[model samples]
Target: MERGFRLILAASLMLMLLDLCRGSTIGVCYGRNADDLPTPDKAAQLVQQHNIKYVRIYDSNIQVFKAFANTGIELMIGIPNSDLLPFAQFQSNADSWLKNNILPYYPSTKITYITVGAEATEVNSTSLVVPAMQNVFTALRKAGLHKKIKVSTTHSLGVLSRSFPPSAGAFNSSFASFLKPLLIFLAENKSPFMVDIYPYYAFRDSPNNVSLDYALFESSSEVIDPNTGLLYTNMFDAQIDALYFALAALNFRTIKIMVTETGWPSKGSPKETAATPDNAQTYNTNLIRHVINDTGTPAKPGEELDVYIFSLFNENRKPGLDSERNWGLFYPDKTSVYNLDFSGRGSVDVITGANITNTNGTTWCIASSNASDRVLQSALDWACGPGNVDCSPIQPSQPCYEPDTLVSHASYAFNSFYQQNGASDVACSFGGLGVRVDKNPSYDKCLYMTTGSNKTLSTNATAIPTTSHSLAGKVHTSKSSWTFMISFLLFLAIDSIRGW
Candidate 1:
């Protein structure tokens, strides 16, 4: 009994540690294929100000490397397809490239992954990818930086021949020879299989078959796989799970997947009606929330899925359809095309204007009138407990304590968690017990907090005696500390039981 108890405790602690150590997996791809984009220094500042910690650049530009230095932002630098032949053909060439580009800024710049080529399968240069990766790895090994920086390549969805129902996902047989060796190399090196996924293209090509709500992660219905009986709520998860099944079928189930590029366009040509600002905002916002929340696909629940939003700025030079040039979250001037909470704590509504400035409109989370008292109480406990919401203001004799009702208390707690977490729809969703409203919920001497701009609501009357609370100073209970406390208590209880 004691051994079993100890085993359970160990397992619990390990899970908690895993949860606590997991950092933000969401990143933005900085593609400077335009002449009007801001300088690397200014771009880096803009990214950092928005709380974005991870960035992926297409090349190892000296200016970009220097700009990101000491910013503590993790970088995934890339090598274009043009350099594949030279790097793959000669080890000296790869060494020279890394020496000139990486060695100087690494450690300081926090360069994590070095992608050799992007979309090699589409370019018909599949043969050069593995060799280029090996030579790059060899160069890093010689520099003693191989362990710190992983080497890999990116692929488009065109590599997969079949991706329906998710369970039957498989790679095209024509590229099996290329993929088998590449998969082996990635598995052996513990590198991720990077792929660019775009649900927008899938929806656009076949609107009748693909639902817009599913593509944007706003689906009210679920699609169940007939064979596996696995349910899919959105196109993104289905697409990812299809990739997972494909990898598993090839006997490379241990290999992890990374989304190198994924995003929606805010503007498009006349034919591209779906490519509106609202859809873009919804797709990117939901995508960030889905990734950062670690809501893994049906095939791999609770897995840490790292994703990079495609193209930081709209590139006018990009050739192809009008939507191709509009996948950026920001314009060339570093202004957002729409409101996006990159921190993954909030929701973004559709903005309709040219060169519009992003703003956090008045929004508040309150208890749903339709929800039962029991549900509200349960959500209240979670918000105040694990959610780490400051609930003192709603206590007895406090400013917000009037009415002393359960719904009233839950509203305060829910809104506190919501605003503290970026005023996001997901933050307000306390298992359907919370509802968001535009009207202020503040009354009497009680004041409610808003998004960063307007900190709190003010009334004409004088304030009541209350303990001040700053959302910035809100203390979170570390998972490790909770684990230790529980373990200690369990150990004491076990000792007492044994004595008895």
Candidate 2:
């Protein structure tokens, strides 16, 4: 009886630890590349107001650090890429950096991780990355704060030579020399391997091949990686699994993966039409829901993931494609680019511009006019297959089948899925394959379902139903704690009985 009690106690403790692990926090990246932005103090206030507990900044600015002090916010600070070579060449430089930058306001501001440099592997002096990290770690140890702060660096998905199958992910041959030692250091020190992943880039580079629905994480169709037989519902999971396979190949599967940056832009150039406000809101809002649900990637199910959205505010001076400058959740004026609740309490309608509160009672979803045949066909298969969109009306002998074209049939199916999914932007976006409209596509004898056409359609819509992928449920943490306490009491009772 005593042994059984002890076993239950140990199991309960393990459950508690796992519960803590799965309750990871969602954070935002605080970038400062623009001239017309609020002061650091105000920015801190903004985050606090939004109830964002975790934040990542590119550099250890004094003003920003001071603002975060006593705010109960956890921060991950950075060292610029330009300083990597200098820090690597001399330990004294690193010591001075820690003394000046960190030792001043550490516990007050809660500095949890020190990112050595932002995407240092991309710079010409990539070889300096590991040495700089080592020096930084040594400095932290010398200051007696090594346990409080972890040292690491971030990488871009560009470092991977191949990421399609995910299982076949391999680092670019050129970066192997630096990555080998770096991975070893990370494993020894128990630091997470941070990477920036953007599904938008994949779609932008290959729109014809990549499904927009998959990129947006709204697809019912799953991408099965033939190599690993792992089913991927969205590009984000595929990207993470790609990194996981890469690490496993290198024999460093133990190190955790954290996303230092990932976000969709709200505005873009002419060709980048997918970068719209509705799309951005949909992506970010859905991402929060996915994280809060504690649903890890297909490769690492049930494990918690730590992620930081690309930026806090959009910067006007940033260089590169227009999308590069527009990856911020909030504009420079400190106003949100769209209605997004970081706390995971906002409605999906607020995000998709559906204005669920005041509907006109006449709306339907349809295939976008610009949707290509290939994209349409992919969405059609998903709707008819996994999405379970009714297709009897679009069959050969049915009234809606008179058109018989892929577009006509697909439009009907897309509308059915969209209407069934609540007519939100997320539902209509079959990866840019579908759109919502007010006019009913129903013709004589075709009878397309709309708000006015059928009460059954409205009832079946499920009124902003939570995502199919939602992992939200009771964590059952307290159950284990209580069980441990009860088991201990039973052990005491058994001892008393023996004495009697």
Return the TM-score for each candidate structure. Answer: 0.72, 0.69
Error of 2 at 340 (Å): 1.2
TM-score of 1: 0.72
Clashing pairs in 1: 346-424
Candidate 1: Cα lDDT at 177: 87
Runs with alpha carbons beyond 4 Å of true place in candidate 2:
1-21, 345-500
lDDT of 1 by residue, 345-457 (tens): 44222212222222335688899878877556667776776565668889999988987999899998888777666667767766567799877677665666666533333
Candidate lDDT scores, in order, read: 0.79, 0.75
For candidate 2, lDDT tens digit of each residue in 1-500?
87677667656755654454335457899999999999999999888877677899999898999999998888999999988888999999999999998889889989999998878767766788889999999999999988889999999998889988999988888888989998999999999999998998989999998988899889999999998788998999899989988999888989999999998999999999999988898888778767765677888886667888888999989998898889998887888898774544333220121222223555667777677775567667767754545587788888789788888888888776665444566666665566677655655566554421232222222333221211122221212223322333333343434444
C-alpha lDDT of residue 254 in model 2:
97
| Candidate number with greatest TM-score | 1
